[model samples]
Target: MPEAYWLYEDGIGEARATLIDDDRILAARIELPGRLRVGTVARARLTEFQLATLDTGEQVMLDRRPPGVTLGSAITVEVVREAIPEPGRAKRARGRMTDATPATGPNLLARITATGVPVRTLRAHEPDLLEQAGWSEVLDEALFGEIAFAGGALRMSPTPAMTLFDVDGDGPLDVLAERAAVAVAHAIRRHGIGGSIGVDFPSVTGKATRQAVAAAIDAHLALPFERTAVNGFGFMQIVRPRPRASLPELLRDDLAAASTRAALRQIERVPATAPNRHRLSGPVGACLDAHPDWLDELVRRTGRTPIFNA
Candidate 1:
């Protein structure tokens, strides 16, 4: 399948770059502000022996503070894990303070283009082919619980420990299980869902059919993940490495917060002469209105107060 990149700006300071393989979104990169991402090198003040929060408000948990470092002392740290945003809490990372700075690597977009994939920037008004191909709906479905396939539906729930997927429908047990397996794998990849995952597939009697379900998972999902075969109770466990927040965590944990942040990002990208207008949904508008400091910052940065329509 031919691969292409879709770079999107939602016109309120938020931008996302999605890599699509034919119709499926293989990966997505979202711009997050005020957080330290993996590979970021910066000087940080040690708040405690093993924890230091950066100037960007991202807290980093270190293996050990530098030998001579004391609380409130400045130390250089390299981010090993990006911050994962959680509800009503600050994003946190895992890193270490070291004396030497490591070489910085290419960013997400640069790395994608380095592989010779074609990239296309999408404006807010432009039509996205990937969205037309059901990828957008998939993202929405992921945010909610109902991810519908042709014959069945997958309900995904993320807990504090792991993500759970429950499959259901009226189709043949084996057929529905196979389809749900593929859908579960797709959801895992599309949402960047990582860590431990449990899938409750429809019960299939034959051992070969159960193995086939596991094979479907292997065929559709990406690598670097280990999964157990379907057991007698029709349950499978998968372990995947998580380096950042999943899409569901970003969008569903706090929809209003996410939309408000996106609006701020859009305002930053507005051209000086372009009227500086923004239209937001009712909830997002309320979120922005509740925070006068953000509006003040927007005005200060752009020199033009945006005309907001709710």
Candidate 2:
């Protein structure tokens, strides 16, 4: 099968590149805010035991501290966990100070290019291809957690402790469970879901049938994960390492926030001679309205007041 890649930039400093196998998106690399992505080295100051703040204003929890390190002492640390944004709180990272320097190499785009895969910039084709791929629906599903397959559906709910998947649908129990297993695997990878996950498949009576479902999961899913066999109660548990927040967690709770930021970025890109009229979605307009300071800053920077339409 031929592989292709699509790179998209929101023109607002955010970028994402997706790897496509034929028409299906197999994986994606997204750029997130903050400098504390996995494998990045940063200078930090210890504020408390095993906890320190980075120069980027992100707090970090250290796995191990250097010998003789004192409070408020500057030290170099490698990021083991990317910053996860939470509502009404500061984003924090997890890392440890080691003697090794951070390794630098090809990024996702460059590595894909080295493979000679056909890569397309989606800046121009974004509207058409994104719609055709049902990208918005995919985003919605990742955020809201309802996924439909041919024979069944999976409901995902992420919590502080673990992420849960409940499978339900019509058709033969064996077939439905098999299909649901495959779908669950895809959803887990596509949404960047990690950490502990539980899938409640439709219970199958025979041992052979449950084994078949497990085989299907093994065949369809990728590596670097540990999972339990499906039990008689139709429950399977999976554990994947999570270095960062899933894409849904990054975008879901703050879509309006992202939209407002995108709008401001678009405004900055607009030519000074262009008309001051700008259109915004209802939610985006409300978000901007809630922050008059942002609008005032935009006016001060662009020297043009924008007329917003909901």
Candidate 3:
């Protein structure tokens, strides 16, 4: 289990993300953040569409269509495996002897090999989910909304626990809110970001505007997730139960080094591994400690750990 951020420079972009393995990222999709400048930095929690093989072959990265995005009737299944050759006896060299293991199997064996699922297989599996998820009108609405020309980018970070949508805007807060709220909801399905989600809409003070924005949030999130009131701080919170990081994050991190840098800001949530369970890390933890009562709250919320580090 690898943890920490990776930075990409030179020909590649630099961003923070959770490097899951040598080649996989557990953070947001950095490459797709709209209108990249020569040196713009973005942080994200990646989403992925994956097909894992029983033989531990290649993990296919698919475009994670939002829940109500699209689903054709037919689906295809792709399988990749190496033909295992029958076991052969190894010849000993005059100076060296090497033990040979049987190379016979149904899939390829290599120090490194990659495989993927067929596209048709992926397409066929969407309808039943659509039916179960009650997605008819939702799909129609999204299709209609997608045609308008507005320039801004929104990305989703879907964890099993929560979804955090970071909206990068080139427009006013009003425009960003309307478009982004919808986009976040769409992304919820696309990336299947569920659980408790905190949508960070650009802060606004106008009462009517807030109300309108709240209504938009409710309308967009009605079906897939239960909408909670926008908190006092204007955070539109919703909950949609989901699995894990979706597709885009998986690929960018796997293919390049940009994903790791996108995650350093969030690593504090994981809690440091330390010997003192009573301690906490980061500003939030420090604040809690300053106030004895809040410190008690922290203890109540998270069980004591033997070790802690900032």
Candidate 4:
């Protein structure tokens, strides 16, 4: 199988795929799976200048400019032509497959201090994932700890793109909204969730309720999330981190959680209200759903009548 690698040179980024032989570059670039080829190269226009020392032990002038590099700009530099890496060589030089571990797995680490809440930390395994989603430095900051629920509770409900929050005065909903919103931001930062999030505040039947929710949400996000005016419907639409999986999905495997083992004796004994039930029962139903087989095959495996659930 061919493998693609990113190439960065002369301030230009290109994706190069090593052919199956891992020797010659494929020239007939129509399209290939998992491959990146140069589509278009745009040059960046140079402006202001900076003086720097080069590898030749000589001072050199370099270009520094605002709106510097665009889709196409030729950066003048020496080009060294070399063949692709051999399969053996490439195998020996590959970077870490997953990322380096820092502390633990996919959960938060925290310790409370006497003078207010001290600080919280993440397990070591979260850094690479956070970095991949553009949240490396953000996690390092102390501001993240402020977003945890402080003398309050937070409610989270899942949505397709973003999770929705309803702030009831249950326990400082405003502050909870801010904290949960920040957690959502971090979730989005850790995973990429992009779209709209709706935050419903309890009907405050008074002025300033909508603005308060909006301000709280705004303060929690590390990135820009635009909002429309509160609609007549009395629901505030919040734009927070739109990430791939909510925190729960990232934490557990659905398949393992769904599996339940039951012995045939236990399954055959479940109470059935039918007048003359001679077919499959509760445990059999589970087995049929999970592992379907021919009717004869099923009978051979577990000599029990297959009861179809109405």
On residues 93-193, what C-alpha lDDT tens digit does candidate 1 reach at each position?
88877676644434555655676777775553345454565555655665687888879889998776788999989868999999999989888877788
Candidate 1: C-alpha lDDT: 0.75
Q: How accurate is candidate 4 locally (lDDT)?
A: 0.32
Alpha-carbon shift of residue 308 in model 1 (angstroms): 5.7
Report the lDDT of model 4 for residue 58.
26
Total backbone collisions, model 3: 50
Question: Each prediction's TM-score against the native?
Answer: 0.78, 0.80, 0.33, 0.30
Cα deviation of 168, candidate 4, in Å: 3.5
Better candidate number, 3 or 4, judged by lDDT:
3
Q: Over 4 Å off in model 3, which ranges?
A: 1-149, 158-161, 243-245, 248-310
lDDT of 1 at 29: 54
Candidate 3 C-alpha lDDT tens digits along 1-310? 2233232211112221221223332222222221112111122111222222112222222223323323331122222221111114211100111123312222111111122211111111133322233232222222222212256665454343454666667768777767777666555554334447777777766777777777876776646567665555657777664322333323322322222212211222235453333333355344434445433433443455223455
At residue 209, what lDDT does model 2 achieve? Answer: 93
Q: In every candidate, how many clashes are there?
A: 4, 0, 50, 17
Expressed as tens digits, the lDDT of each residue in 76-127 for candidate 4 is 3211111111223311110111122322111111101121322222222223
